[model samples]
Target: MIEADRISKTYARGVYALRDLSLRIDKGDFVFLTGPSGAGKSTLLRLLLRRDVPSEGQLIVGGRNLAELTPRQVQAYRRSLGFVFQDFKLLQNKTVLQNVALVPRVLGMPPSQQQRRTFQVLKWVGLQHRMSAYPLELSGGEQQRVAIARAIVNDPVIILADEPTGNLDPDLSLEIMNLFREINARGTTVVVATHDRELIRRVGRRSVTLNHGQIAELA
Candidate 1:
């Protein structure tokens, strides 16, 4: 469902975030992206999400070229994929339900349908009881669960998570990982970028490792 061919990103001052990296992820496959800091994992994720374009080569999603897409098309393409971030980028001022409902609302979904999906996904993430709580009122793990709910509420075909377990303890991290595994088992393609070696080992899926802007290993 996703393909990157010789993709590279070079910023100003000669810093290359990614270098000639090519990878393919098929539909319903779960893959782990792992590397040290400054290893270009985040850059790769950004390219996939169209948050940043590669300075060289091609990125194709669902058979559409990301490099050639217009802004409107990029937005439309993103609607097919879900993104989770390390920081849990929830709106502090919005209630959990409202925050989870934002994307469907933007797509002009009916109120009843949006509410139904939001509640269902929040429940799946084990945060249904916290639906009315604001971000600050919840613990770190709870906030991350809310973020997960928001990502999957649309039932996107691909789920991309950048360091989704970075801030939690081992037990809590395992809980979140199990949630991701469940989603992957249900036929959603799951790609997670993380530095947690133990977690990666525990999960035991194929992993692509980036080092010095290039893919140093893949297993």
Candidate 2:
């Protein structure tokens, strides 16, 4: 779960990327964040992930205050999250299996356990057949599926997807949205930041909209 209170971000030029923003996402909820460019949707995600410190206010994710975590704690906090990006940030040379295996391997999971978990998520994404394929060899949707597999390999409790459907065709976008819905059904809290209104509407999830760097509406 995530809670943001009175959060604001301002740049040197006096541009406010987020202004007095506040939100609460409960466990097992699937929420869509929709906003145009410069609306601070991505900024909110970055702040939650601790990729950027907020200019003001408080953010608590999974019960840990973003402002007070030690370096080690922050690293551990991130391990509890699964993240997908607009661009599939896959390792070009790594096979799909290897890409999904990286997180568990880094955590010192036994080989058998790693293989089992990797295969399970890949199977969920319908990419178990492509385990040996490299990123370049896979289609855009396939690559994004691999990215999703990699993200959930460790069984993270929260999933943050930023523009996850931004690059795919309509059909593929729907496929990805379905996968996220399934993941949410399994109890992982899901939050996606996207601009595709049609996709969001089709998915029929709760949505929060932002404008002028502030939350303008929610439904």
Candidate 3:
């Protein structure tokens, strides 16, 4: 669950990315964040991930106030969340299995557990056959699926995807969305930031629209 209370993010020279933004996302919920460019959707996600700090107000994720966390605790907190990006962000040279396995490997998971989790998530994303392939060898949709696989391999409590389907064709976009929905159904909170209105309408999930760095609508 996430709670943002009047949170505002201001960059150097006093440019505000978000202003007095307040929102709450409950556990086991799926929410869509839709907004125009410069509307602060991405900024909000960054704040939630502790990648950036709000210049004002408070952000509490999974019951801990983000502002109060120690550097070590911030690292630990991020382990409970997953992030997918508009760009796949896969290592060009790493094989599919290795890419998905990196998170657990860094966390000091045993080799056996890492292998098992890597295979399981790749299978979940329908990429079991491509585990040995490199990122360049896979199609765009396939690469994106691998990214999703990597994101979920840790069994994160929440998944935050920013324009997850931006590079795929319509069918593939829907496929990716369905995968997120399936993940949500399994009790992981999912929040996606996208500009694709038709996709938003098609999915029919609760959507919060931002305009000028504020919540313009929530439906």
- 1-219: candidate 1 lDDT, tens digit per residue: 999999999999979999899999999999999999999999999998999899999999899989899999998988988999999999999999999999899988999999999999999998899989999999989999999999998889999999999989988888998989999999999999999989999988889999988999999
- lDDT values for all models: 0.93, 0.92, 0.94
Looking at candidate 3, the ten consecutive residues that score lowest on lDDT are: 46-55
Predicted model with the maximum lDDT: 3
TM-score of each: 0.98, 0.98, 0.99
> Per-residue lDDT of 115-190 in model 3, one digit per residue for the tens?
9999999999999999999999999999999999999999999999999999998999999999999999999999
Write the residue-wise lDDT of candidate 2 on 48-164 in tens digits.
Answer: 788887788888887778989989988999999999999989999899999999999999999999999999999989998999999999999999999899888888899999999
Model 2, position 159, has a per-residue lDDT of 93
Cα-based lDDT at residue 123, candidate 2:
96
Error of 3 at 60 (Å): 0.6
Best by TM-score: 3
Off by more than 4 A, model 1? none
- Residue pairs clashing in model 1 are none
Give candidate 2 regions above 4 Å deviation: none
